[model samples]
Every structure is written in structure tokens, then in C-alpha cells.
Target: MPSRTSRPTRRTALLCAAGLLALPRLQAAPAKKPLPPPPDVWPRPALVPGGVARLSLGPSATRPQAHSGELPLLVVGDAIEWTALVGIALAAPPGEAAITVAAPGEAARRVPYRIVAKKYQEQRLTVSPRTVDLSSEDQARYEREREHLAGVMATFSPAVPAQLHMQVPVPGRRSSSFGLRRIFNGQARNPHSGMDIAAATGTPVRAPLDGRVVDVGDYFFNGGTVWLDHGAGLLSMYCHLSAMDVKPGDQLRAGDAFCKVGATGRVTGPHLHWSVMLNRAMVDPALFIDA
Candidate 1:
């Protein structure tokens, strides 16, 4: 009996094809960049508002989780020595508050802490009537943009941030206008949620730390805006930008130029409105900036 002619097996053919594909890929692949070093852990204060408080997770082999008033907090370090980054809201009442810390296979524990009252200054400014009172059409547009921005600010990515010590995005004098209750044209508005840096138009705005660009768009109030997610519910926003160098999904490293300062939105001059968000709450930018 004549034996059937030998044939190349499917598995053997697949191996040859895979080897051919890998050869070109290995030759053309670019060198991988080294990651930035982790940031130094800042000292956690006891009474926190514009600061962060640390909560001990105790001795355990498993990593722990934390929360402050229903808002999930940032937990860093290992099991043997874990600390919860409790971000106290600017409007958080100055009184007894508790943080819930839980570890795997253990009951959740509440760490009681107090928040001290911090008095913010008042600023009265009489801007143009159009800015204070938007027209019906502009108001509708502003509302729509507001909703869009709220979604951007609420982004929480799983990527853990490397450096927490952030550089000032733009080189200028950081105005003491943060958290100011402003009277715009005799109409009181929400307190200022960001730090205003006085800078000339076209000044290059750099990324304070490594992060991914989550959103970029021109808003009614924010004008040309860019939102960066530094991971673990830590977000940063740059408003009134003249131009953007990156878009959503773009990853940037510390000191990378990402935007330019401008008077694009509702602003009195060319400057940058930088806001830092922790656990979706807009906190003082001074909390993260080193210089």
C-alpha cells in the first residue's frame, strides 16, 4: 500500500509564521522609556481640609482600603505599613469626622479625626454684566458645557500615580485668590475652586506631574481646557488655555509642555486657572504643588 504523501502540519506552519512576524517586530520596536520615580510621601496633618490626613491601617499582610465620608480615599504603601490619604473637602465642616479603613478578611474600622476651620478671604469684583448674567442662549450653552466638564472632573483611572510632588504648571505668581467668595457684579457665586496664576499670554504651560490627558475642549467658562488624570481619583485641570498640545489618552511626563496660558474664557487677563481634584472634590492646588 502506497502511503499518503506527507503534509505540513497546521501547528508547524503556525510556528513558522509566528517566528517570521516576531522577527520584524523585534527589529522595528522602539526602546521603552524608563518610568519616573515615585514621589516622596508628604507629611500628613491631623486636622485636614486644604491638606491630607494619614490613617494607620495597622499590621497586616493584605493591602487595605479607605474612605472618608463616603468618598473613597487614596491608600499608599505596603501591608506592613499602610497609610490612607484622607482628602478633606474645602467646605468640610470643622468637627469630628471619621475615616473607614478595611483590610481583606478583616472587619472595617473607623478612624475618628477632627477638621479645623479655615477662614477664606472675601473678594468683590464687578465684571461685565454679560459675564455675571449670561444671555438665554449662552446660559443654555454654559449649562451643557458645565455638565460635560463635570464628567471630565469625575474621571478615576486605575493607573497609580508615580510622583505626587507636582511642579507649578506655569511660571508666575500664584494668586491668593483660591477659595475666595467672589461677588461678581453684586451677584455672589460659588467659591473659587482653583489657583489663578498670573501669566502673560502664550506662556507655555507644563504638566506638573506624569498623567494621562483625559479631556480637552473649549468650554463656555473654561475656554480652552485640558483635564489630566493622575490616577487614583487625583485629577488636574488647566483652564483658559490658548492652545493644547495633547488630547484625550495622551500620556505626559512631569515638566512636559502641554498647553499655553491665555485669556480665552471668562477672564480679566491672560492667566491660568489650575484646579486639583482629589476623590472628585476640587481641592486647593497648593496641596500638591512643590514650587
Candidate 2:
């Protein structure tokens, strides 16, 4: 019953659509996805105890996958040659080793590697009997702390770090070096797992690189400890702190104050125990230092 004008003929409808199109339009363009941060220039890693090995996967048209037994490799590169950074454990015996490399649609290849023996100096220390001979409660507490730390060190993210050259946390003399076979209280203990830097108590400790605080806790050995996750299975630990300035889930940039160095834990004097972890294994921090 409507009029012909209300019903609209094809010509009229076309005219109306033309007018609608002439009016101002409100539409948004599709948002662009953010690109990942640029990868850092690869550092040369040594393949010895407490060292990092930079193993090449050869030139390939695509990225390759590599692993050493249960440990995953951090591979970096593109359509060109790719390399892997392998963290050698201090306890690893020097001998021939191989890493399994696999490319898409290709069989995995176990490339042989050699680990040369490195002599580490020994240090004798006289510490408290309670530290050397742990009580039942102390042993239980250490085990619990150890479990918690293992979880922190096991963090693996696909994000590649923006930088590898690290800044010195707190300026101090490198006192107790890494991998020192220490005879403590006449009993042999595990080789030094981290570097001991002699710094004054209450001295501010900064983050060596960009990272997120994954853990902050107190322990029998590493008192007032803090763990930073630097993406791609790279972790850094700051132990024996006098005070912690950051907490879990906090973001930190390179040289940002994180805590204060202290002699807390099982140390004789004030120092910072700096440990660099790659693929859950503690490796040498010296490898990151720029020459």
C-alpha cells in the first residue's frame, strides 16, 4: 500500500546509495602486528667447563633445530648460516660430544664436538660448621629451596633477547672466581657454581641486561636471592643480597638497580654471587663480557 517513492525504484535506490557514499565515512584500517625485537649480535662462546659454546649448524635455506640430549639449543640466524649457543656444565668431563641437528624434511644429524679440559684453581675456606655440616632442618630447607630454584632456571621462552653483552652488576673485584674447587671446613663441596664479586654491603646491584624478575627469596646458601629471566632459556641470578629492590614479575632494564649486595648466605664477607644460566645449566658469565 506504500507509495512508489517509499518503495523506491532501482534508479532511485541507486541515487540514494550514491548520496550515502558521498557522506563522510567512519572506518578503521586493519592494525598491523608488532615485529619482534632485533636479535643481538651473537657472542663467541667457549666450549669448556663453565663456558658457552657457539656451534654452527652450517648454511641452510631454513632454520635448523638442535639439542644436546635433554637440553634444547638456542639457535639464532636466518636463511644464512645458523649457530647454537651451548652452555657447558662445570662437571662435564672433557671429551668428544655431539649435538643433534635437524632441519625440516631432513634427517637429524649428530655433529661431533670436542670439550677440552680446563684447569680451575682451588680455594680453601674455613666456614661455620652449621654451613658445612647441615642439620636435618637445614638440609630439608636447602632441598626445598633447590627445588624452587630449579623451576626458576627451567624457564624457556621463544623470545630472543635483544642483547647478549652484559653490564657488570656492581663494580667490584672478581674475588672467588667461577668453578673454583673449594675445600670448605676440610670437606670438599661442589665446585663454585657462580662468580663471587667482593662488594660492600648495601652497595646497589643493577640488572646486567633486560629481564623480568622470576623469583625473589631467602635461602641457606644464597640468602636474599633474585632470579631474572632474560628470555630464550637465558637466566641470571643475583645472590647474597643485603636487600632486594625488585619483586617477582617486575621488569628491569640493563643497569637498573635491582638490589643491594650483602654477605648474607654462606659467605665470609660481603659479595655478590652472579650466575649466568643457559638452558638450565650454569655457565660462565665471563663469556658475555665485551672484549
Candidate 3:
């Protein structure tokens, strides 16, 4: 009973109403895209006594995942950087730790890793003619110096603002004896705590990153030692210096000269003993340095 024009008009109105109703769903379909896949998880060996676990993150843009026992895993990501922290779950138990990291867009890459743990040991050293034997007065001086060193280490900050900037403090031949077991005069000693760079006497030492000079002094063991506090609980140390050019509280930039190499500590010849600490844990400086 409807006219042809009226029928066409009614059909057009119906089609327009249906289109209006479907528009919201079409817009929402894009919003319902599936999230990215979770990262891969790996289990680590049990932690050593008085030691914490160390994790090396792969160079990937994807976020990382970490779970602590019954607690939910925390995954944090930023534009191109990602990091995760997993607290020690066991008080003194022997169990493995699992860490998961997301792959970067399905691409394969070789990731390097190094882990260091603290252990207790007794060390002995031979008293060479060059070794400074402390008198009672000198002994007091050494104790005071060590206490100051501990204080400086306590105030260190660990959060690195930029990629870990590092350099060999002195230009010299690296000793293969680094981290070696030593038996001096038929007595065992602790493994070398730092890398030994053999350089000529009075060779200038430089800072590897921006930091604040926290302690500088001569001791019976370390000789002329300098400790730098890089913010975020990170620290760098220069030991056995012939001279300390920087004073405490002074700020330093990368490549800044801080000392001159010398055989001041328990050493055979002139060298710079450079060490790095992260969250009170000593790690291999090679991990942060380019070969």
C-alpha cells in the first residue's frame, strides 16, 4: 500500500539505523587486540651463603618478567629499556630461581652473562722488604683508613643513569693472573678481588663514569686508595696510586684523571687495581667494559 518513493525512503532509513548500530562495534574491535606474549623463563642455581643472585638481561626491547614464590610476577617496561628485580625468597633453603624475559620480536640474539657471589675466606700475605710493616702508630692509621673506606662504601649509590660507562684506569698490559689463586711464601691468599693493569710508575688513572669522590687515603694494605660513589649503590675504586689528584666530595666525569699508578699495595710492580661494586656485590669489571 506504500508508494515506491516511500518504500525506498523507508529502506534507506533502516539501513542507516543498522549502520549506526554497527559503527561502535567496528571501532571497538581494534581496541580488543591481544596483548603480547609473556617472556621466557629460566631457572638459576641456588644462591651461595651470604650471596644474592645476579641476572643479566638480554638486549631486547621487550619487557621482562619476574616472580617471587607465591607473589605475582612484576613486569616493568619503558621505551627501549627494561629491568626486573626479584627478591630472595628463601631464608636458607636450597631452591632454584626462575626468571622470564620476553623475546624481542621473535629475533634471535646471543646474550652474554656473568654472575658473582660473595663467600668468606681467610687470606695470608708475605712481607716483602717493599711491604710496609706498620708500627703501632701506623697500625692505628691503617685501621682509621679502613674504617673510612667502609663508611664511603656504605653511602654508595647504585642506580646508573646511563648505560654503564667504563674504561681501564691505566693504559697497560692486563695480567692473566687476575682472579688467580695465590700462595705467597707457601701461604694461601684470597682470590684477587680486582683486575690488575700493569702500567708504568706514575701513569695517570682516569674515571670511567660520573661519580663523587668519597674517600682518598693511603693504607698499609691498599696504599693510596680512592673510592668513587656512582649514584644508585654503585661504586668504583682505584687502588695503589702514587698520587690522588681528586679530593672527597669532588664530582668527576668520564675519563677524568683521578690518580697515578704505583706499586703501593701488596704488589710486585706498578699497577692500578680497579674494582666495581653493585649493591655491595663485587662483579667482573669486564662485564661492563668493551674489550
Candidate 4:
């Protein structure tokens, strides 16, 4: 007996044909492109009224003859209630003023910052007689020290990156506040330029962020001092140290031990005087730290 020839059922044939027709159409569809990364959101930390933003200033802002050195960059914005980070750039002689923004039509704007340069007068003190006396020789010494410090401050590279996080150099209660109206011996003096951390002698002082030691010296007023450049016109100074563990050009990391607290300079007691300077203007360091 001849077996019945197998044949394709009409329903099965139609289904197969339809599937074959769909294959080409599915393959012809366009491929999907990838999505872009998200935009950066800045942390809105509360800033003191008239507080300056910490940022880097590039080498182009400084003298061209010197291929290397840091230029101090300070940020001063119009006094406003909301907190925002401002970027600043300085142009050489024939300086033109203009406001630039990251986006067009944005309410936030940058304005021309007028920085007035002032010459600081130096006073000398004699330890033996416990008198604040200025001798010709002492005056000369003070002038030399002042010049050296000014040079160091000038070398601050505006190219160095700003510190993203800040911590107290040592665990202590804050005493003398930064920018306080300070009077010494019945005479009004310049406002306090740095924050004073009241800690016992020998307390370890740490760096608040990664940076390079730009200057270190013992001065008549600052006592033992260390300045760290954390890029772009942002520099940190630690003074009145009993001991210094780092020197100029030494690289340091955030929270690294840099010195020990002391009352080395003209101070009441052992404490860490921490300062942040932008474009030579002494600004409050607390604005950058979380605590």
C-alpha cells in the first residue's frame, strides 16, 4: 500500500509565510542611540554674606615672564540671599569689565569685581624687653619677612583645583572668628584674617584637602606657618603650629597630618589659626567646609 503523500496544511503555510514577511521589516528598524550623562548639580552650602567662592585662576592671568607661579583668584559677588558658586577671571592691564554666564537668559549673572590694592604696614616687636618696639634692624627684618610672604602669596596658582570638602584641622572649639574686629593693646588693628581653633598644644593639624605646600616659615606674628595651594587661587594657611611635618612643594592629601597646634606666634594660647586666601583677599574658610 502506497503511503499518503504528506502535504502542507493551508493554515500552517499561511502562518509560515507571514512570519517570513515580518523578518525583513523587523531587521529594517533603526537602532537606538545612547542617552547622555546627567548634568552636574552643585552643593548649595550656605555662604556668609559677601562671602567669596573658592576657585582656580589660570597662569594666563599672571605675569607672562614667569612661566611658573600661582596667581591668587578671589570671588566676590553681589550680596544676595541665595547661595551660588561664581567663577571669576582677571585680565591684565587695560582690563575691560563684563559679566559672563554659563547659560543665556539665566537670572544668575557675574559682575565686574573691583579689587582695590592696598599696601600693608609692618610693625616690629622685641621679645627681650617684652615691648612692641621697632628698631632699624628689626624694621628691615620685618620688611624682608613681609616681602617673602607676599612673594609666596603671589605664587598661588589660580590653576590649582578648589577644595571640594573641608574639615577642621584639629578637634577644638573655635575662638577668634575670621574677619573679627580685632583691637590690640587699645589700638584698632586689621580685622582678624584667619579662624582660630582653640586646641591644646601638640594637637595634630590635618590638611582639609589635597594640595601642595607652597610656603612654610616661622614669622614674628604667625609663628610656625604652612601654606597649602589647592589650585586656582585657593590657598590654605595653618599658623601657630608647635611643629610642622610638611615643607614647601610637599604633596599632601585631605586629612593628612601637617602640623601640631601651638601658641608659637603672638597669640593668647595654643591654637590653630587656619586661613583661606583668594586673590590675596583673606576670606572665611568656614564657607567651604560642611561643618
- CA lDDT of each candidate? 0.81, 0.87, 0.62, 0.62
- Give the per-residue lDDT digits (tens) of candidate 2, residues 1-291: 867867568778999999999999888997999999875554556778888888878888877888889777788877778888888888889998888999999999987888989998889999999998999999999999888877888888777788788888888899988889999989988889888889899999999999999999989998899999988888999999999988899999998998999988998999999999988778878778754
Could you report the Cα RMSD, in angstroms, for every candidate shown? 20.8, 18.0, 14.9, 13.8
In model 1, the worst 10-residue window by lDDT is 39-48
Compute the lDDT of residue 241 as modeled in candidate 3: 90
> Scored by Cα lDDT, where does model 4 land?
0.62
The candidate maximizing TM-score is 2
| lDDT tens digits, residue span 1-291, model 3 | 877799889999999999898785544444666888864322122244222344555445545443333332223346465444332321223444455444655643332222334343334446673345457876897788768767776673434435454766778787633344555666665556567788988999988888899888887778889998876556778888999998889999888988899989777778888876644555456645665
Model 2 lDDT at residue 171:
89
Give candidate 3 misplaced runs (Cα > 4 Å). 1-81, 84-142, 176-178
TM-score of each: 0.81, 0.83, 0.59, 0.61
TM-score of predicted model 1? 0.81
Question: Looking at candidate 1, what is the lDDT of residue 19?
Answer: 86
Sort every candidate by TM-score, greatest first. 2, 1, 4, 3
Q: After superposition, how far is residue 144 of candidate 1 from its true place, in Å?
A: 1.2
Model 1 superposed RMSD (Cα): 20.8
Candidate 4 to truth, TM: 0.61
The candidate that wins on lDDT is 2
